[model samples]
Target: VLRGQRPDARVIEAVRGVTFDVAVGESVGVIGPNGSGKTSLLQATTGLLPLAGGQVLVRSIPAFLGVQA
Candidate 1:
């Protein structure tokens, strides 16, 4: 089961099996077409979204600073 939901239930996989690494001070960008999971990947990486499988490791906790405000 995922997030208290049934395993057999239909669900949308916004992101799946994504893997990568970024060294300190390295620059990176997440680019994709609409509904291609760019935001989902970022959310999963920063713990905003629960991961269904695989793992996410970071040197430190991520902070989400929105443009607004």
Candidate 2:
């Protein structure tokens, strides 16, 4: 969903119409060029970003930034 050069939600869609599934004990990487919403997607998926578009389900408790569980 590479809409534009910059990560702009208003001007263009960063991660548009994207979805996927992962099994237990699996690892995935969100790789892309700069301003490609890599971090945005990760944060959104981890319940760090505000509820602007979709939903995020956390099966287990997450370890947030600067905090320990």
Candidate 3:
């Protein structure tokens, strides 16, 4: 579920009920095989994608750098 604007089409849920926290000095990694919601989680967290449920609070805005060829 993408966040703000409601889509005029069908919805596909990629990630669900994912929760976690990171401290100032903590480093977290997301690991999973293909089609395991890894990219979805990052997109939702960084505000590139809207969240269907729950909330995300970040100390600073996230910057998304595309993977270059």
- Per-model TM-score on C-alpha atoms: 0.66, 0.59, 0.65
Give lDDT per model, in order: 0.64, 0.57, 0.67
Rank by lDDT, descending? Answer: 3, 1, 2
- Say which prediction, candidate 2 or candidate 3, comes out ahead on TM-score: 3
**Per model, how many backbone clashes are there?**
0, 0, 1
- In angstroms, the error of model 2 at 67 is 10
1 or 2, which is superior by lDDT?
1
RMSD of 1: 6.1
Cα deviation of 63, candidate 1, in Å: 13
What RMSD does each model have against the real structure? 6.1, 7.0, 5.8
Superposed by TM-score, candidate 2 places the C-alpha of residue 5 at a distance from the truth, in angstroms, of: 23
Q: Candidate 3 clash total?
A: 1
lDDT of 3 by residue, 1-69 (tens): 453454575566778787687897999999999988898788766667765666666655443333311
Provide the global lDDT of candidate 2 against the true structure: 0.57
In model 1, pairs of residues that clash are: none
Residue-by-residue lDDT tens digits, candidate 1, 1-69? 123356676657777667687887999999999989887777666666566676666554444323211
lDDT of model 3, residue 7: 58
Off by over 4 Å in 1: 1-10, 59-69
